[model samples]
Target: MDSAVGRCREIRLRAYPDGMIQPSDLTIIETALPEAGPNDLVVRNRWFRISISTRLMANPDAQAVEGIPFPALRPGDRLADGAIGEVMACPPGSGFEIGTFVSHPLGWRDYAVVDAGSCVALGRGPIEPAAYLGHGWTAYAALTRGIRIRRGDTVFVSSGAGAIGSMAGQIARRLGASRVIGSTSTPDKADWMTAELGYDAAILRNRGSIADQLKAAAPDGVDVFVDMVGGEQLAAAAEAAREGARFVLLGALTAELNVAGASIVAPVQLDSFQLILKDVTLRGYSADRDSAEAFPEWIAWQREARLHFACSTVAGLENAPGALHDACEGRLRGLVMVEV
Candidate 1:
């Protein structure tokens, strides 16, 4: 294996106190690349994905992000989250030889030296980095494995224009759902959901009470609820559920609201008696858990399903901070990928 290496560029969080992700919060620095030791491999990142969850990691409050423990951000810390790259160097006798494509939770950089145990070897599938992250595997897994979506079910998805919501809506359709409804913040997104994404109905959640809007959209009652925004949206979904409905809580973008002055509130209040009467099965899910356990199975299923996803890409490592900023402000639509 080639051991020759030089300097590389990476981003680090300055200080995550509060508010949205500022360009000032991230610093891009050039530093000498560390050589791979035994059981270590060096990767040249090709692409990386930005997620809203990163905002929580940046400025987390104990009261806001309960149960999810992440180390406090400080300057000079390597900001590695999720990255896909090719092995540039590997120790002799290591199974992760050079040129191998792999995915790891070490992003925000052009190069990384990671322990072999920390990376997941990726196959030569035709999957793009954007599709790999944006395809809503978590949403699909939650619907299939967590909710057990039945054929002809009426499905409702919140935040339908976003990555997971878009995927979940289409996947529900592919799974034989009779009706797929989605809620979005804008009319354009709502139109896209119904026109391009094959959703049966789209509700403008930002204009009306989520519960009232859901009632108008799914007048017959929703059999499956895939929630992205928590609080009132969740409460509204629960209110609109039919008997024996399944609720998969994927994200609560409203959960922490942002690390600043926002206090963590139960996006919505659920009455135990109403839940009991409706026979709703509510569960929270993270796609990473399924990926860690059954990634191979996921790949096979994805191939069999032949699912398609949409994404927007930004080139160059220097533009990543701006891309992340766009994501935080809800400017970028679909998956925002940085080509490193």
Candidate 2:
């Protein structure tokens, strides 16, 4: 008999109505690996964890109507940062080897049994697998397809020290931007952007009206805006835009507020006038769409040195909560991972 069973843990979010998510909003439960059916591969589950966007709860008024192809929660499932694991066993006729390292779109669990087709093999490489979490597709999507950023353009990026933003700035520089101006909250991050990443300049976002500051910094005005903080930032980007700029809208960290009504939950609103007049293009991106092109492109970028990546290391399933707390509190930067 299988002794007892291989045990794994999962986090389930309670019904949170106010967009509130704390460590207590998560419930940790022990569960056993699913018995693999046909063509199933049971991974020993090495490293896996969550990102902040996936961990936050949403009220219906502010809830996204839908997300990408990631499966929705069942009766017992939850939304959290995902992880990578190693294949320890495979059912007969499954083509996977037992020792392959793979990443799947499952939550913070110790062991996972997934179909062979559901994962991407972590080939022997210099790039860390977890770096592929947000850093991989995100930077590629922003520059290549999302913004169509060109050489000799001026690019303005928000949250410039973050996982996606930092890589995006570097890619812009390599892709031949004449100048890359980034906005960060502190002098320390601004200095890091300029000195370490080869950025042309960085403005301290907390110091002044970002719109006026960016306008003052870019006498020619911005040609591309890779925006993460919406509301005032978006409004500012729109105002500071030169003729024919491409504004790639990626996030809304400043959008959500607990307004009394559905329409008012977010203070961020976009005016179509500037986009129409200045020949400015606004577009939103999700990585899963057209990943068929992105994956190979990403592999090439990393190989060619245009893309640099990093991740925060964690160990074991027991530390999931603490790791998540660290991520939330800004103690760790880049994508967070558990080494198992």
Which regions of candidate 2 fall more than 4 Å away from where they truly are? 1-4, 14-20, 57-64, 67-76, 124-127, 256-272, 290-292, 329-331
Tell me each candidate's TM-score.
0.91, 0.85
Clashing pairs in 1: 80-107, 81-105, 81-107, 231-267, 231-268, 232-267
Model 1 local distance difference test score? 0.75
The ten-residue window of minimal lDDT in model 2 covers: 256-265
lDDT of each: 0.75, 0.67
Off by over 4 Å in 1: 1-5, 60-71, 123-126, 258-267
| Best-matching candidate per TM-score | 1
Superposed by TM-score, candidate 1 places the C-alpha of residue 294 at a distance from the truth, in angstroms, of 2.6
Q: How do the residues 1-340 of candidate 2 rate in per-residue lDDT, one tens digit apiece? A: 1226766666665444334344655567777667777877777666675565543333333334343343333324565445566777777666566777777776477677777887777743343664556565676677888879877999988877766677778878877789998877778777877877667888876587887888877878889998866777778878878889998877655532212311222356566787788999988765556444677677666767745564677776667767765665555645677766
User: What's every prediction's RMSD, in angstroms?
Assistant: 2.7, 3.5
